[model samples]
Target: MKPIYSRIVATGGYLPERILSNRDLEQMVETSDAWIFARTGIRSRHIAAPGEKTVDMAEAAARQALADAGLNAADLDLIIVATTTPDQIFPSTACLLQARLGNRGAPAFDIQAVCTGFIYALATADRFIRSGGARHALVVGVESMSHIVDWTDRGTCILFGDGAGAVVLSAGDQPGIISTHIHADGAYADLLQVPGGETRIAMQGNAVFRVAVRTLGEIVQETLAANALTPAEIDWLVPHQANIRIIEATADKLGLPMERVVTTVEHHGNTSAASVPLALDEAARRGCFQPRQRLLLEAFGGGFTWGSALLRWG
Candidate 1:
């Protein structure tokens, strides 16, 4: 019997219409455009309209992905949603999205790893495909970070936006996902956390930045070594859009020029789990990727989760 691999059939992304620029943040908080942009490399972020939910964004991205893949909802045998801000506590966001898409019987659930959620979900979906558990899988990373943001806090409010990114994975004979590496540590949880009942995100900016740069650098090295590939073989780096410094550090470590990195943090901010996929979809639409090209995706999130995935464009 031949081995099965999960290949990325198509990708889709969505961001809310509202633009919250750094100038806008200046009025909301005591931060200035120069200060915010200089530090985070973020110019603006999109805000969902009133009552726009995570499931709503997820549905839009999913439909776009399904359309791109030329696949119907019924074709999906598995659905996974990576979200930190789920629409509800009982019905998982994946289930709600499945219901909206009219997909029946496909096992749908959610994964919560904050920013690293999408990579984690993608790895799981890859496993299912490899294990002969599912042929078609829909993986989405969506977030409404504003839902829990402290509007008055200069620290967290300016750093997040709402968006969704989706991808359709199909079973293939060739190597789709070349390798995936994931890891977590709970000790640094307090460095970035939002209380269970409180609707606010509290993060130690400098501390988190330092740790993210270190861990992300290490993960990229591990990913490169795991696949026995050198930095020169990598075509692009799709990274978590948490901070510009962290992204730059990782790219520098890989010896890849900044031009080889797919960065959307300037406009998207950090959409938590949606960050990497959002960047990935944008680059793909721009024709930045070529078939058989090597693309590396990575993320570091709250829960102290960090991971990397290397894949060939399929």
Candidate 2:
């Protein structure tokens, strides 16, 4: 039997203009640059200005992805946005983005898995492609964490930034996603979740940290085993850009070196659902990911959700 391929034709990302450096954060809250950098490795983050919403960012990223894929907005058959922070609580950010992009009548919706959003959405889109339900799909991961952040809390406030990333996935008959694994422990959901207004960003930092590291390691191992691929076969390990420590620990467990890890945490911070694709796009722009390269993507976040995917980079 021949294998079906869900190929990523192009990628794009958007970061807001308002740059908030750790030093800038010090003025807004009682946090030191040294502390933030030491703990999260976030030097600066993009803060969206007033009136710049999640849908706007998604639209911008989608436009670029469409252009890169050499397709028109009307060409997209599906739009899936992985987001926790939507422009409104009712209209899914995906739907809003579809309207903004001048795309009419296509199925559009938002998937909420906190930080694992992109992986969740990617997996869903891949399934749809494999089922022959859609030919061209736009999968986007975007967040406006700044809107929900409690600026007074130094711990959480310094750890997040705002941005969006997207990719154009098309149906093909080749090797694309080799394996995937997803898991969630709702019991620990309280460990890292918003508490009010659709849950404000409230979390038990220590607990969330422990689970993130441990689960991320387990998922990587599972992905490898499922595909019969070894750590040595991985060309890039793009873990969530939550913290430098988490990234280091996951790589250590997989026996992969730091240089092989694709990271943007130092500049992008934790853009929630946006981190994975943002890092992928960043690496792609740098020419770090080559065609047919083996890439392992993993993430863990709110909802206590975590997942991993093994892909043959295109």
Candidate 3:
């Protein structure tokens, strides 16, 4: 028999104080805000305070998610952090977050799937919950991409921002995750990837843009068909906040109108791993996601990783 898992009880997000607008980038580089906004739909993005690390932002978001779920750190059984830019090369940022959150016993680790991170982490948490290894899991998608971008390169620097978002998943027998689909085409890995220093970002913008649109549409159709659902049954469609064009293409291919797509790219920019969860939390807070609401979430990023999940919020 297939094991059953629970619903995500609560969601929360935390953004840094510094807001870097495309205008700000224009002053620093050769690009204009209009070009950036027209292409990516990103006007501004947040930057972590001096000395703030990925773990710090993850902890803050996790705390809020816990509070929203009416649970505490002591109650958590697992913590999974989805990030490409971790606080360090070792010790895993998820473990650091667990230590900081006052949860000494929970098993914590980090996953590096670039932008599709939250969906990857969510699936991991769901499996653990299903297998009866964990009762409550904290899944956080945090990134400090601002610290790593080559600010001198207008092509990449103007496209990313930093932030974190978290969700608290608890055990239940309701329809939470109906179906999930994950895909990767490593042949295009170099299309958009940070090449070195374990810090700096390296990317080929044009090529990655084309692949993202194609893969997102294909995987979304596969996910919907597997779940026995149709585009009309979806209450909301949330795509990775990489670029507005990417989101629009994905929505169009799925036959969903732009109005039905939840977007925060105009305000948050491409927050990488944090984008999806941050959008979800913001929508949940605004009362957009009702109980039993069907939401389809998708993301694509470095590693050429992409994933989709169909869920009915419990």
Candidate 4:
């Protein structure tokens, strides 16, 4: 009998209508557009409307993914939503998203690995599928990061945005998610995080930048090794939309050029957990990916968490 592999059947993404440009931040904070763009490669980002919850964005992305996959909520045997800024602390965002998608009794939950969350959630769902516990899974990375940004803190305020991205993974005989690698160091948690029960986010930019570039490069190599492949074998690099510099550094480490990387940071900023899948969906929609192409996905985020996933595009 062949092993069941979880493959991404379809992808989808959603960004709120409100656009917050760098100039807008200039009016609100003490920063220039050139400075923000030069450092983070972000010129504009989306801001969710007041009352727009994380679950709302998750549902929108999930629905689009379901439609793209030609599957419905009923087909999903599992649902995992990766987020740090959930609507409430009581019910997990996964449960809220399930309710909104009209899905029930499929082991819905949330993963909080901060920005590496989508990769974490994707890995978890893959395990369930490989273990025969599930056949179809909905993995979503959604965040209302704008709500957590300290508008007064120019450093952190200029870096985050709001959005959601999702993928439908289903059991198959072919290789789908080839491999995944995840790592974390709580000692560095202070480098990037939001204090408990607080809406404001804080970070040691320089510290996080150095560590993210190093760790992300290491994990990408780990993932490639696990799959017995090399950076040159990857057709596309779908990286976390944290910063263009970080993305470029990772690509450089992989011996790949910037053109091979799927980046949305210039327009989307850092949507936290939503970054990777959002970029994936955008690339997929634009017909940038070909069936059976080798793709590498990676992310680094707040828990001082980071990970990578290698997959065959479908």
Where does candidate 4 stray beyond 4 Å?
Answer: none
Backbone clashes counted, model 3: 1
Q: lDDT tens digits, residues 176-250, model 4? A: 999988888899977787888777998999999999999998998898888888778999999999999999999
Clashes of each: 0, 5, 1, 0
Model 1: residues with Cα > 4 Å off, grouped in runs? none
Task: Find the 10 residues in a row with the least total lDDT in model 1.
Answer: 195-204
Q: 108-214, model 2: which lDDT tens digit per residue?
A: 98999999999999999888888888889999999999998888888789988999999999988887877668888899866887776564588788888888889
Checking candidate 3 for backbone clashes, the offending pairs are 6-172
Write one digit per residue (lDDT tens) for candidate 3, span 129-214.
98899999999999999888888998888888999999998987766877778877788877777666456788888888888888
Leading candidate by lDDT: 1
The C-alpha RMSD in Å for every predicted model, in order, reads 0.6, 1.2, 1.3, 0.8
In model 2, where do residues sit more than 4 Å from their true spots?
1-3, 197-199
Please give, for residues 71-159, the per-residue lDDT of candidate 1 as tens digits: 99999999999999998996999999999999999999999999999999999999999999999999999999999899999988889
From the highest TM-score down, the ranking of the candidates is 1, 4, 2, 3
Select the stronger candidate by lDDT from 1 and 4. Answer: 1
